[model samples]
Structures are given as C-alpha cells and as structure tokens.
Target chain A: MTYCVALKLDRGLVMMSDTRTNAGLDNISTFRKMHVWEKPGERVLTLMTAGNLATTQAVISILDERMKAPEEREPSIFAAPSMFQVARIVADTLREVIGRQADSGQKADAAFNATVLLGGQIAGGPVRLFLIYPEGNFIEASDDTPFFQIGETKYGRPILVRAFERTMSFEAAVKLLVVSFDSTIKANLSVGMPLDVALYEEGSLSLGTPWRMEANDAYYRTISEGWGDALKQAFDRLPDMELPTSG
Target chain B: MTYCVALKLDRGLVMMSDTRTNAGLDNISTFRKMHVWEKPGERVLTLMTAGNLATTQAVISILDERMKAPEEREPSIFAAPSMFQVARIVADTLREVIGRQADSGQKADAAFNATVLLGGQIAGGPVRLFLIYPEGNFIEASDDTPFFQIGETKYGRPILVRAFERTMSFEAAVKLLVVSFDSTIKANLSVGMPLDVALYEEGSLSLGTPWRMEANDAYYRTISEGWGDALKQAFDRLPDMELPTSG
Candidate 1:
C-alpha cells in the first residue's frame, strides 16, 4: 500500500510519495518510492511507484541498469526522445517485471502488478506528466485533468480537487501535497511518514535535490495541526440548517 | 451505488442518505434510501440502505409488513425490546432477501448484498447507532466510533474524522453531514442530489419529518460553495515550505 501523487502545473511538475510498504499488517517496511534519473542540462525524469514491491524494484533496477548500459539496452531512460517515450519505457518495464514474476510459477494475479507516476522533460519537449498502468498503458495529464494519484488516493483527493491550481507557486503546490499526504497518513496506516518529494521547474531541464519530510518535521506538524484547526473553523462558518419540527 | 451516513452525538442521532440508485452507469434512478418507523413518544428507528436496490427494498418491505402485521409475523420490528434486537431483525431481513435470491439459482455474488445503517432510541435504551452487514451481523457505534458511513464513503471521510465531536450541536452536526454528502456527490456519479435526512433527538422518542434537500436547495448551495472557499482560505493559512536549493 502506497500513496503517490503528481501534479502537472503551468510552472512545472510536483511529485510526492509515501515510503511505507507492507506485506501484512505486522510486516511493514520503509522503502524509497521516488526514483530520479537526471541528465543535468539535457533532461530530468522522475518516477513514483506503487504496488508490488518486487515489481517496482525490478522495474526501477532495470530502468537504472538500462540508463548506465545504453549500448546493451536500447531506449534507455536517459535516451527517451520525449516524456511520452519515457512513460512507454516505464510501462513496459513494469509489465516485463510482472511477466517475469508469473514466469517464475506465481499464479496469474495482481500480486506482481505495479503502477507508476512519470513526470519530466527533455531538452526540446515540453513538460509532461503521465500515470503508467501495470498493463503497459498510460494516460497523460492535461488541462482538464492536471494531476494523477495512485494507491490510497481517495482519502486525500477531496482536498486536491478543491485546492489544486495549475498556476499556483511551487511553494503552494508542495504545501498542498503535504496537506494531501497528511490526510492520507492519518486515515490509513499503510501510508506512513518520511515522504519523498521532487520539484521539476519547467524549462530548467534539471532536477533539484529531492526533499524528504519526516514524521517530526516542524513544518509538517504545523500544517497537520493547522489544517485541523482550519477545518473546524471552516465547518463553523457554514450556515446552520433549519431542523424539521414535525414528523 | 449510494452514500448514507449516520452520526451518534450527545444530543441524539443525525442521519443523511443520497437518493440515487443505479443498475449501471446508463441506468440511473432516484429512490429514497432513508426509511423511518416512529411510534411517537415510544420509539424511533431510522434506517439507511446502500448496495443492491432489490435486496434493500425487499428487506424494507419485509420489515414494513411485519410491523403492520405483528400477529401474523413473529418478531415484528415494533416488538423488538431493544435497539440491538431491532438491528438483529433488520440484519436477518437483509440476509433473508439475499438468501431468497440465492435460492432462485442465481450465482452467489455481491449482486444481492446490501449494507444498512440503523440508528434511533427505543424508549429506555440509550440512543444507539449500528452498521449491519449482509451476513446478519452488526456493530454498534461506541464513544471511539460514533459514526457509520456506508457506500462511497472514502471521499467524505477525512472531514468527518477531523471535525466530528460527540458534543457538537445539531446545527453543527447537520452542517458537517451536508459537507460530507456534498463531497461524496461531487466525487461519485452514483451518489446524487435530493438527499434524505433524519434527525432524532434523545428523550423525544420520536423521529421528525425527514428533510429532502434538492440540487437547487439554497442552504445546500451555500455550504457547498462556502466549503470550497473555506478550504482555500485554510490552505493559504498554512506556512509555506522552503524549497531545496540544489540537487
């Protein structure tokens, strides 16, 4: 169980993901879900994964290895002609990983399935964001639908739907993601702390250092507690309903 | 495809249910999901249904018949001595309906399952709320869990978790319910307008005339729009995060 979200804003892309992975309630572990492959001045690519840990790790490892050994593996993550091609490569990697799991005698089921959020840019292409499915298919975010959420998405969606703006500053975008993730972490045990975040400013063609937010981060605490107080006050501001007097 | 929620507060019980039902995305219809049987000054029982419409309607019909013909039908709903017994009767009725469908040679599936939320006072018994499953079992709300939401519950849950209070006034409770329902309606096509609501004040031993809120209802509009603005204001109040300087 994981919660990963990416927004394709007018300025660039903002992505965040929880680090918790669990085989069962008692068997929980923390693993980085956000993976980055940057080419400095040429391109920047970010991937956030959710689903079977083995499948995601395998997909990431394959992508990483392909980037380093482009002579051996064609269409490397670093060599994708555009963001769409990158999404296609990531989707194929996910399906390839799941296929390997099935070939290893595991029954055909969703056990090896993985979903990935891919967002980045190349030197010539415009910034793009996509949600890649386990089946090697993907959907790009556009003006009407500017964000994608995977895994435990519902708990945090209302806030995003109400607050997200394509023109908002990176600071506000990060703050919104924090509030969204905070709501999810509080509601679901599967999505825990120490969130991994990446900010890609359009046209920069470079990825900045990713930020990690821990459970005890003062800013996270402020937003968590402040949001609660704000919500209560907001509830109070709604006009009261007139109760029916008779049956 | 419905959304019904009930809250057990210090004052009494506040329940709300959307009126939408659907056989498929193309075959949507409106049907009342909230039902009430009140013996003025003696007892009040409010039930909200979600899931298979046939199963729910059958269960409601059986309960309605048993109440009117107590001499012919043993363990009539009105004859139940306690709220727990009332829940038992409702749960059993639900299973009976599903069992009948199974006996008709239909493949056993969730197609015939229905979940119910029941809440009210039975004179001497304290005001109680319950969530009855299709398998003839139910769980009562406690101090820790003072609310029950069935069908398309996730989108509306965060607000309830953060804002609900046991001692909140009926005005606040109803306002909270409206916000919750509004969120669900926006997120799910299966849950629509013309919501049915019931208010049971403890010691009254009677249910008031259930209110019907339409899509064009003025107060509903006020809250729906007000909530969006309030949330935006709340998000703006949260302190901004300092972006990482380098990779």
Candidate 2:
C-alpha cells in the first residue's frame, strides 16, 4: 500500500507520497512513488502513483522513456499541449499496462489496477490537478474538491477535510499534508516513511527538486509528536456526556 | 455500512453504534445495531454488529430466541458460565447463520459475513470485551488492544488512537466516541445518525438505558460543529513547514 496526497491551493500544488511498497507482510521495500517531468519554463508535470508496483512502474517507465526519446514515441507527456492532454496520456498508459496483464491470462485484472494523482502546469494553461482511476477515467479537482488522495486514504482524510483552505500558503499546505500523512502512518503499517514531496508554485511553469523527508527529519518528527498532543488536548476540550443515573 | 466501536476502559465498557442500514446507495433505512441482554444483578451483555444486515439480524434473532427459551436451547448466553462462553456462543451462531446462507446457494459467502463486538460482565467474572469474527473465532480486548471497531472504521480511528486511555471516565470515553463518529459521518453518507450508545460500569453487573443521540440532538450538534472548529485550531497550532526558496 501507498499514501499519496496532492492539494490544489491558490498559491500552488503541495503533493506528498510515502515510500513503502510491500508484496506481502514480509516482502516490504522502499520505492519512490513520485515522478516528475519538467521542461523549465515550458511545462511541469508531477505524477504520484499507488496500487500494484509492477503496473505503476511500467506506466512511469513508459512515460519516462517517451520523454527521453521523444522522436520515437510520438505522444510524450512533454509535448502535450495542455494539462488535460497530460492526464489523458497517463490514464491511457495505466489502462494499457493493466489491460496487457489481463490479456496474458492473468485471472484477476483488478490485481494489476493502479491509480494516479497528476498535477502541474503547462506554460499558458492554468494549474490543474486530476485523479486518474484504474479504469482509465479521470476527474479534475475544482473548488468543491481541491485535493486528491490515493492509497490508504481514509485514516488521513478527516483531518484534511477539516483543515484545508484554498488560500493557504504553500508552507501551510505542506504542513497540513505532513500531519495527514503522520496520522495515516500511525494507523497503518503499510504506509511508512520516508516521504517524497513536490511543490509547484502557480504560473512558475516549473517544479522545484522534490524533497525527501527521512524518518528522523526534525520537522516531520516535531509535527508528528505535536499533532498527537494537540489532538489529545482538543479531545479533552470537548463537552463531556452526562449520564442519567436512573438506569 | 455501519460504524460500531466498543472500548474496555478501567471503569467498564463504552460502546456506540450508528443506526444506518442500506442495501445500496439508494436503499437506506435506520436500524438499531446495539442489543443488550441483562439479568440485572447477575449479568449484563451487550452486542454491536456490522456487515450483512441479514446475517447479523439472523444471528441476533437466534440468540434472542435461545435466551427466551432456555429449556430448549441448552447453551443460551444467559446460562453461560463466563464471558468467554458467551463469546463462543455468539461466534458459533454467527458462523452457523453464514454457513447456512452459503449452503443455500449463496455464491458469495463473503457477502454474508458479519462481525460482532461483545462486551459485558457476569457476576463473578471480570469486565471483558470480545471481537467475534464470521469464522466463529473471537479475540478478547486487553490492556494492549483495549478497543474494537467494526465497519467504516478507518476515518474515525486516528482520534481514538490518540485520545483513548484505560483510566478515562465513561463520560470522556463517550465524548471521544462522539467526536470519532462525527468525523466518520462527515466523510461517509452510509454511516449516519442517530447513534446508539451503552455504558457498562464494572461491578454494577447491569447497564443503564442506552442513549439514542438523534441527528437533531443538541449535544451531538454541538460536538459535530465544535469538533470541526477545534480541529482547524489544532491544525493551525502546528509548526509551519519551512521551504528552501532557492528551489
């Protein structure tokens, strides 16, 4: 299991993904789930994947190879005219990989399914974020839903729903995502640290080098411990239930 | 879908369950998920269920009938020697009902599975709680794992993990549970009000009348709105992330 979240704030997009990948309880490994493509001031695209490791890696590898050899692969993400086109390419690739696995007599096609979170800007286009499903369909985040989370999402979702705002700074948004990720990591062993994070400033048309937050990272440690304490305090502040003595 | 949680605190047991029952998104009705059996000064047992409504209802009906006709049913929960025996009786009934459904040509046995949370005290026995599976196996809650939640559990679990303490008062535990349920109800439409709650104090050997928190209940509304504000304040209190501007 993986936990990847992308927030579309007014300032920009704040995205985070866990590094743990496991085939089973005993077969766990660290793998980067965030993939980014950039052509400086022209276009910037970030993709975070969750689901079967083989299928996601295949989708990423195909996209990466296309970027490296654009002449051979006609419809590379780099040359896509808009963010919508980039999403289409990613969705199609995901479906193609899973479809191949099923076509080869794999009894469970669902076993090969993968979900992707794609967010970035392409030159003149407005910043956009999309959640691409395992079925090759995708939906864009709007004002009503300004964030998308894939993999081990439920434990971390309530906090996001409660705290997120459109006008939050990039720094505040990243902090919020960290807290969300911490809650998920504590409840589920499948989503572990270190984390990979990417920040894209609106209209910059370029993404910074993604940050790697190791387990012992000072800030992550502070937020993880601090959030637990804050939660306890908040819980204590709630009005207590008064029991009736009769029964 | 449903959300039922039972905690074994030092004072006794605190349990809460939602009233939503649905065959599909469009077919929803309210049903009580919490059931209690008491012999006043002798024993008090409470059961909360989740999963297929048919299987759970069938299991509950059989248990209720056996208790009503103890002579014909030799192993009724009322005559059980200990909480362990009561758990076994409930687990066996659950397994029996599911097995019968599968035997009657139900293609998807998993669809008929039901899980139960049983907690109570019998005269000379210690206050105990058990999580009974559809397979007729059950595990008791202990100092280490003092609570059990069944159905739509993930969204509401983080706060419980952070706030639950064995020594907390029954009022505090119920307050914490309301917060948890509020988070779940906000995130999922399948689990909704009103809620059913039961409190069992050790040595009392009996449970008071269960509380029904209706959707319009003033206290429930206060906690629901207050929690959202408290969570936002908590999120703002966390240290903001510092980003490298050079990137």
Candidate 3:
C-alpha cells in the first residue's frame, strides 16, 4: 500500500508521495515512488505511482527506455506538444508495459497493475494533474474536485475534504497536505516517510526543486505535534452530554 | 453505508452510531443503527449494526421476537447470565435470521452480512465490548486497541489512533468519539446525522440516558466548528519546506 496526492490549485500543482512498500508486514521496504522527467524550459512531467511495485517500476523503466531511443518514439513525454498529449503518452506507455509483462505467461492473479498520479506543465499550456487508473484510462482534476489521491487514500481524506479549495494559497495547501500525510502515516504502517513533495508554479515550464522530508524532519514533527495538541483542545471544547439522573 | 463506534474505558463504555442508509447515492434514507435491550437491574446490552440494512433489520427482528416468546426460549437477552453469553446469543440470532432469509431466496447476498458492535455490562460483570463479524464470531476489545468501529471506519481512524488510550476519562472518550465521527461525516456523504450516543458507567447494569444529536444540535455544532478551526490552526503551525534553490 502507498499514499500519493496531487493537487491542481490556482497557484500551481502540488504532488506528494510516500516511500514505503510491503509485500507483507514482514517484507517491508522503502522505494521511491516519484519519478520526474524534465526537459528544462520545454516540458516537465512528474509521475507518482502506487499499486504493485514491480509493475510501476517496469512501467517507469519502459518510459525511460523510450526517452533514450528517441528515433522510435515520436510522441514521448519529452516531445508531447501539450500537457494533455503528454498524459496520453504516459497512458499509452503504461498500457504497453503492462501488456508486455502480462504476455510473459505470468499467473493470472500476478498480472501487472499500477496507477499513476501524473502532474506537470508544458511551456504552451496550463499545469494539469491527472489520476491514471490501472486500465490506462485517466481523469483530470476539475473545479469541483481539484485533487486526486491514490493508494491508502481514506486515512488522509478528511483533511483534504474539509480544507482543500481552489483558492487556497500554495503554502497553506502544502501544509494541509503534510498534515494529511502525517495522519495517514500514523494510522497505516504501509505508508512511511522520506516523503517526496514537488510544487509547480502555474506558468513555470520546469518543475520546482523537490523536497525530500526525511523521517524526524522538523517540519513534519511540528505538524504532528500541532495536530495532536489541536485535537485535544478541540475535544476539550465539545460540550458534555447532560445525562438524566435516573438510570 | 454507516459509521458506528463503541469504546470500553476504565470508568465506562461509550457507543455512537450514525443514522444514514443508502442503497445507492440516489436512494438515501435514515435508519437508526443502534438497538438497546435492558432488563434494567439484571442486564443491559447495546448493539450497533453496519452493512446490509435489510440483513441487520432481520437480525434485530429475530432478537425482538425471541424476547416476545420468552416462554419457549431458555434464555433471552433479559435472561442472559453474562454479557459474553448475550453477545453469543446476538451473533447466533443474526446468523439464524440471515440464514432463514437466504433460504427463502428473498436476498441471497444479504446472508450473515451485517457486522455489529456489541457492548454493555451485566449485573455482576465488567463492562465488555465485542466486534461481531458477519461469520457470527467476535473479538473483544483489549487494552491495546480499546475501541471498535464498524462502518466507513477509515475516515475516522486517524483521530482515534492518535487520541484513544486505555485510561482516558469517560468525558474525554466521548468528546474524542464525537470528533472522530465528525471527521467521518465530513469525508463521506453516506454517513450522516442524527447520531445516537450511549454512555454507560462501569459496574452500572443499565445505560445512562442516551443522547440523540441532530444536525443542528449545539454540542455537535461546537465539535464541528472547533475541530475544523483546530485543524487549520495545526496546519498553520507546521514548518514550511526549505527546498534547495536548484534541483
């Protein structure tokens, strides 16, 4: 299990992913789930994946191979004309990789499966965020639901539901996201840290410097401490029930 | 969908359940999920059900019928020797009702489909809480995990993970529970008001007067407002990312 979130805010795009993977509780391991493909000022695309780690890594490796063999691929992530076309390129690459893996006579239950949070900006268009499903189909974030979450999503859903908005400042958005991730991390052992967070300004063609929040990072510490204190204070403020004297 | 939680604390027991049921998003209705059976001084039992509404209703009907036919039944909830025995009776009745309904072919899928949170105190026993699975088996709450939630549980899990403790005061437990419920309600539309809350002090054989909190209830209003504000404050206190100037 993993937890990854991407937000399409007016200021820009914010993407975060946890780095823990477990085949079972005893086989837990850390793996980077965020992959960035950058072509300087032309295009910048980031892919955060969840679901079967082998499938996701295979898909990423295939995409990287395509970028290297530029003669064979005309519409790779590096050359896509727009963000929408770039998303199409990603979906196509994922489908092909999954198909190749499935054709190897693997057991039916062991078929390749992965979902990706694709977010980036092209020089000519707006920053966009998409949640690509295992079937290679995808949905873009819209005004009503301006964010997408994949993998172990429910534990972190409350903060996003209550606080996310199109008009939120980028700073507030990132903070809310960290708090959300903190909640998820505490509740689920499958989602651990060394969080990868990327913020893209709306018009910037290149991605901003990605932040790696390590375990015991001071900012995450503040978020966790503050949240715990706030919950206690909130609990204290709620009115107590006035029970009847007779039982 | 529904959300029901019951906690076993050192001083008492706390139980709360939402009243929303939906066949689909288009077919929504309110159906109380909490049921109480008390012989006052002899025994007190509360059951909160989540899952197929028809199946839970059938189970409740069976229990009610057994009470009505006391002459034929060797032991009813009113006559059960201990809370543990009462839980077995509840689980068995649930399975029997569901089995009978399936045999009639009215709804085969509904067979033994409801999960229940059963909690109460018998005249001579300690307060006990059990989580009854659809298979008619159950697990009692222990010191490590002192609370049980039956439906739409993930959205509310973070608060409980951070706040619940074996020695929490009864007042603190109830407030923590309301905040947890508020988080779930905000995240999922399928779980809603009014909420039924029952608090039973340890060694008390009967429940204290249960409170029905409606959408506009003052205490609930405070919980919603206070919790949202508290979360935002917590978010603000988190440290901002200090990313390197160049990637």
- Report the lDDT tens digits of candidate 1 across residue range B1-247: 8899999999999899999999889999999999999899889999999999989999999999888897884687798999999999899889889889978989965789999999988988899999999888999999999999999998999999999999988888889999999988888898999998888888999777888999999989999999999999988988888777432
Model 3: CAPRI class: acceptable
Per-residue accuracy of model 2 over A1-247 as CA lDDT, tens digit each: 9999999999889899999999889999999999998889999899999999999999999998898897884589988999999999999999999999989997988889999999999888899999999999999999999999999999999999999999998888888999999999999999999999999999898788998999999999999999989888887888987776433
User: How close is candidate 3 at the interface, in terms of C-alpha RMSD after superposing the true interface residues?
Assistant: 2.9
Candidate 2, superposed: residue stretches over 4 Å from native: none
lDDT of 3 by residue, B109-139 (tens): 5534889999988887888899988778899
Model 3 Cα shift for residue B90 (angstroms): 1.7
The sequence of per-residue lDDT tens digits that candidate 3 reaches over residues A74-181 is 566877788788788788877777777778877763446888999988887888888887777899988888999999999999889877878876677777888889
True lDDT of residue A116, candidate 3: 92
How high is the CA lDDT of each candidate model?
A: 0.90, 0.93, 0.82
TM-score of every model versus the real structure: 0.97, 0.98, 0.91
Of 1 and 2, the candidate ranking higher by DockQ: 2
Better candidate number, 1 or 2, judged by TM-score = 2
Q: By summed lDDT, which 10 consecutive residues of candidate 3 chain A come out lowest?
A: A238-247
- For each candidate, the DockQ is 0.70, 0.72, 0.48
Which candidate leads the pack in lDDT? 2
Docking class for model 2 is medium
Interface RMSD of 2: 1.7
Candidate topping TM-score: 2
